[model samples]
Target chain A: MFAAQAFASLFSSPAKTSSPSLASDHPTGGQAAHHAKPLFFTTPHHLKLTYFPIRGLAEDIRLILEESGIAYESENISFHDWHEGGIKQQRAADNPFGQMPILYVNKGEFILSQSKAIIRFIARSTGLDGGDAYSAARCDQLAEGIADLRRQYATLAYDKEFAAKVGDFINKTLVNSFTTIERVYDQNKTRYLLSQDRVSYADIMLFELVDQILALGQDARSVVAKFDRIGEVYKSIAARPRIAAYLASSRRVVAINGASASVGAFKA
Target chain B: MSGDGKYHVHYFAGRGLGEIARIALSEAGVEFEDHRFESLPADLKATTKFGQVPLLVTPAGDRINQSTAILRFIGATHGLSGKTALENAEIDQVIEGVNDIRAKYRALPADAANEERIKFFSTVLPQWLGYFEAILKKTGSGFYVGSNVTIADLYVYVSFDSVINKTADAQPIDAFPLVKAHLEAIAARPRIAAWIAKRPVSQW
Candidate 1:
C-alpha cells in the first residue's frame, strides 16, 4: 500500500506534467522531448551528471572525471524522492529515456543519456580515449569486452535467487568469461590496456569491473584473482595520483551496486 | 591469417545482436560471410573474447567479440561512423537507447498472459517509441544522428523492425509519424531492402 502511494505521488508531482521541451528559453531547462529544439553537434558543454545514489552505471564516467582532472558536478537522486517525490526535485525530466546517469552539458544545453555514450564523450575530451585510430579501436574492443563481463556480474548482483546462483556464476561464468578476457589482455603485453605510456578509458572500465566483482566477497575475489592481467591492470589504474586520491576521498561512491543486490550494497 | 580478404560474422541465424554489424557491412557495400550457429559449440565459444557470439573475424583472422564492438570496428573502417566526436556521441546515444529498451524487453517472459509482458507492450514500448520519435523530429534530417544514414540509423531500424515484426502490429509506428517515416526511408534504401528480401526467414 505504501509503495503504491509513493509511486502515485511520484507520477502526480507537479513537474511530471511539464515536459523538458527545447523552446522554454530557461537556459538550464533541459528540453527532453525527441520533438525538442534543433541541437547541432558542433560544440562541447559543461559537464554535470545526475543518477541514483547507486554506482550502477555512473561509476565509469565518474572514474573518467576524476582521472581527467576535469571539474564537474554530480547530483544524487535518492530512492525516497524517486518514489515519494519525483526526480524533478533535483532537476526537470531532461533525460530522453527518463533514466539517470544523464550527462547534462551546460546544465541541459544538451543531455547525453547513455552511459557508454557519455563515457566516450568524456574520454575523448580528456584525451583518455586513445591516441591514434588503431589504439582507439583497441580501446573500444576492451570496453565492449568489459561490458559483457559486467552484464554477467549484474545478473548475479540483482538475482532474487542470488545466494543460490552466485557459486555457479563464480565457478563457471566468471571462469569462462575471464579466460577470454585475459587472453585479450595478454595480447597487448603492456603495463596498460592501450599502451605503455597512456591509460585509456578501457583501462578505467576494466578497473571498475574488477573492483565490483572483488566486492562480492572472498570466493568471488578468488575467482577474479586468477586473471593476473586484469589484476595487474586494475592495480596500475588504482595507483594513479588522481585515482588514488579519489578512492580515499568522500566523493567516491561506497555502494558497489543497488540495495537489492545479494552483496556489496554498501551505502555512503 | 586467412588472407581471404572477406569478413566473417559469426552469430545465431537470426538478426539479433549480429544484425547491426551485418547492416554496417551491407551499407558499406562489403561482401562477408554470415556464419550462423543454431547452437554455438564449446570449442568456438572458448576462442571468443567473451565466450559470446556476434563475433567478427576480419580478413586478417583477428577474432573480435561483442556485437557493438564488431559494429564499431566496421563503422570505423568504413564511412559508417560519425563525422565528428560530437556526432559520434550522438550516434552512440541513439544506439544505446535502442539497447536499453531491448534489455527491458528481454527481461520479460514471452507470455501474452503475463501481466508485466502485457504492460511492456501497452506502456513501456510506447514510451520508448515516443522517445525515439521525439529524437527523429528534433534531428529533422529524417536520420537519427546527423544528416546521413549511419550505424545509428541501422541499429534503430533493425531493433524496431524485429520488435514490430514479432508483435505483428499493422501500424506499429502510426502514433510516431517521424519514426514511421524514418523506418520507411531506411527500408527503401537499396542495400537494406535487398538484404531484407534475401535474408533467411526465422522465428524471432
Candidate 2:
C-alpha cells in the first residue's frame, strides 16, 4: 500500500503534494518540470514568528525552523511593555485571538495563531511532522503528551502549596509524566520519538519540554538518566548542528519567570 | 476497509475520546474490533504507550493513542481529512477550538457545586457554541471545512452531541441554531446513525 501510494505520488501534480508526502520526499521531476520552480523553494513564503522576548511557546517553532533549514524573522514583542499599552491594542487588533506566537506566512498575507496550530503548520510545510498517517498520528500523540506535561507543570507551579509539597509533586506528577514519556521512547525504540531515522517535530517538543523541566531546578538529568532511550533522544536533538548553534547564540533568550516563563516559574 | 489489516479500538465503555474515531471508522465503512473496558486491564494499562484509553491498534498492530491522533490517522487514511494544507489548517482550527471548550469543562473540579455547572452552561457553553456557530456561518457550506464532511465535522458533532444529550444533567443548546442544525445533519448520516443506534450506552 505504501509503495503504491509512493508510485502514484511520483506522477501526481505538484498541487497534490500533500503534507505527508512533502514531509517524506521532494516533489518529482514531472511535477517540478511542468512548473517554474526555484532551486531552493523549501520555504514558499516569507515567514515571521511573533511572540514575547522569551522561548515560551515559540521556542519549539523556532527549533522546527532551524531544523528544517528555513530562514525566518523572529519578532520578540516585549511582554511588559505590551501589557503596559505598548502595541497592546495593535497586537490584539492584528491577532484574531489577541494572543502572541502568531506566524505570519508570506510576510503578512496569511496569519495563524495558537502555538500548536503554528507548529503543525510549519512542521507539515518543512516535512518535519511525519511521512504518513500512522507516523503523523504518533507525532501528534507525542506532541499532545508534551502539552499534557506542560499543563501539569503549570498547575503545580501555580499551586499555593507548591513550595511546601515540591517533593511530593516531583515524585507523583513530574516523575510519572517523565515515566510515560520514557515508555513512549522505549516502545518506539527509535533514535527520535516516532521515526527511526528522521527527527520529527515531537522530538523537538520533547527536547524543549525536558530542557524546561531542567530549567525549573528539578533534577531532570537524574529522572531521565533512568530512561536511557529518552536521554539519548534528548542528547541527539540538542546536539543537532542548527539546534546547538541556536542554543549557544544570542538569539536564544535566557529562561525567565512571569512573562518569559517557558518551563514553569523559573528564572535563568 | 480497503486494507486487509485488522482494526481494534481500545477504549473504556463510555463514549468519551473514542467516539469520534469510532464514528470516523464507521463512516469509512471499515470493520474492526471494539475493545471496551469497564476497568482498564493492568497489562494493557501498563503497556499502552501513553498509559491512556482510546488507543487504536491499527490493522498492522501499531498501538496508537491520543484521540486527535487517531482521528487524524483515520481521516487521512479514509479520505476524510482535508484535501489541502489550508483546508487542513482550518479543520485543525475547529478541532482545536472544540478541544479548548472540552478542556475548560474538564478543568472544572469534579466535585464542583451546582452553581459552577450552571455558570458553565449559561456563559461558557454559549460562548464556545457561538464560536462554532459563527464558523458554520462563515463556511455556509454546512461543513466545518471545505465543501465536504471532514473529520472536523465529526469531532464537532460528537462534542456537541455529548454535551447536549449524553452528559448528566445536560443543558439545552437551542441558542445556536446553526450548530444544532449541523448536529442534526451529521446524526442523520446512515453509518453514523447506525452506530448511534447500536453503540453501548454509558453515563458520561
Candidate 3:
C-alpha cells in the first residue's frame, strides 16, 4: 500500500509540473510524454470545466483531483462567460450538449456528462477506487444512492412549489431512505464499508451528502444520529488528510471575488 | 487532440441523467470530452434526437443518446462493464431494475395522492430494494450484479439517490437499512468523498 502511494505521488508530481503550460502548450512532446508515461491515463487533453461560478455540480471531480493528489488547473467559467453571443456560437461549434466540465484529451476530446461518471473515472485512475473491483462497484453504488437522495432534495427544495410537496418527500422518501444505509453500517464490523479496511470513493460521497444536509440547516445530523455506524462512517472520511486541507483552504470554496464575478457578469 | 485517444459526452448540470456515465468514465481513467450546453442553444437543439440533451459525440462523429447507452459504450472500452457474457447480462438486469423503479418514482404526478407515494414507498420500493438486497447478499460482498462495478451499480445508486432525495417528504432513515448501508460504503471512498465536498451542498 505504501509503495503504491509512493509511486502515485511520484507520477503525480511530474504530471502536474509537465502540464503547467497546458492551456497554451497544446499537445507537444512534453505533454505527450507525460500522458504516455502513465501506467494508465485518462483521455481529454483540455477539460473546460463549465459550471456556474458557484459550486453547483463540478465539485465532485475537483475533489477527485485533490484526493488523488493530481494537480490540474481549473477553468471556472460562469453563466456570464457563456452569455456572449460569440461564446455561445463557439460552444455550439465545440460542444455537443453545450455543457461544462468537458475534458479535452490528446487524441482529440471525449465528452463526459453526469458527475458520477466523471468522479468514478477519476477515482479508478487515482487508486482511490476501493481495494478491489467488488469494493469499487460498492463505491459506485453509494454515489448513486447519494444522487438519488439529492434528486429528492432538488424536487422539493429547488422547485418553486416546494411548500406543497416538501413534507412527504422529506419525511417518507428522503428520511426513510437513511435506514437502508444505517442497516448496512450496523451489519458491517469494519470501520469503513467493504470491511472497513481503506477509504473508498463511496465514503467521500456519503460524507458530502450528510454534510450538505446539515449545511442546508436541515438538521441532517440529528436524523442520522440514531445510527451510530453511519455517524462513524462519515467521521472517518472527514478526517482524511487531503480532504481536511481542502476544506480548510480559501480556494476550497467558490472563488467569489469581484474580479472574477465582474468579469463573469460582463462576459455574460 | 489525438484521434486514437478522443471521446466526448454531452449533458447539462445538476447531476441529472448523465452522472452515471461520468462516474464510469472517471473510474476507468479514460479521458473524454464533456460537451455542455448553456440553456439549450437552437442549433444544438436541432441536433438532439429528442431535443433533450446528453448526446455523446465520438471523434468518428458517432453521436449517441440515452445516458445508459453512453455508459455501456464507455464501460466496454474501459473493461468496467464485465468480464463475461453472463456477467454483463446480470449487470444489465440490475440496471433495468433500477430504471424501472426510477421511472415509477419520477412519474409521481404533481397532484399525486399520499397513497400513491405510500404505495411506491411500501410496495414497489421495497420490492425493488429487496431484489438488490438479495443479489448483494448472495455475493457475501457489498456489490450487486457482478464481482465488479458495472453500469448496474452506478445506475442503482443514482436511482436510489434521486428517489430518496428528490421526493417532497421526509421519512425515517432506518426503513431501508441495506440500501442505506450500500450507499454509505460507496460514500466512504476518498475520491468520492472529495467529489462530494467539492460539489455544491444544495445541489447534491
Worst 10 residues of 1 chain B by lDDT: B164-173
TM-score of each: 0.84, 0.84, 0.48
On DockQ, the stronger of 1 and 2 is 2
Q: For each candidate, what is the lDDT?
A: 0.74, 0.72, 0.55
Our tally of clashes for model 3 stands at 112
By lDDT, rank the candidates, best first: 1, 2, 3
The i-RMS of every model, in angstroms, reads 14.6, 8.3, 17.3
**Candidate 1 chain A minimal-lDDT segment of 10 residues:** A29-38
> What C-alpha RMSD separates each model from the true structure?
10.5, 6.5, 20.9
Give the winner by lDDT: 1 or 3: 1
How far residue A8's Cα lies from its native spot in candidate 2, in Å, is: 20
lDDT by residue for model 2 (B1-204), tens: 233377789888888888887898888777788889899999888878888988888766677789998887777666677655555656776787777778778776655466777688778788777767776776788997767898999999988777777455555567788888899999999989998898987876
Q: What is the per-residue lDDT of model 2 for residues A50-125, given as tens digits with 9 covering 90 to 100?
A: 8877777788889998888888898977766668867767765344344678877666655666788778767765
Chain B TM-score in each of the candidates: 0.94, 0.92, 0.82
Best by lDDT: 1
lDDT of 1 by residue, A1-268 (tens): 0012222221222122343222133232221211111222223346788877877899999998889777678888776676568665444346566666788766565567789999987776566766343455567777887787798889889899998998898889888777777888787788787777588999899899888888878998888888898888888889999999999988887887877787777454
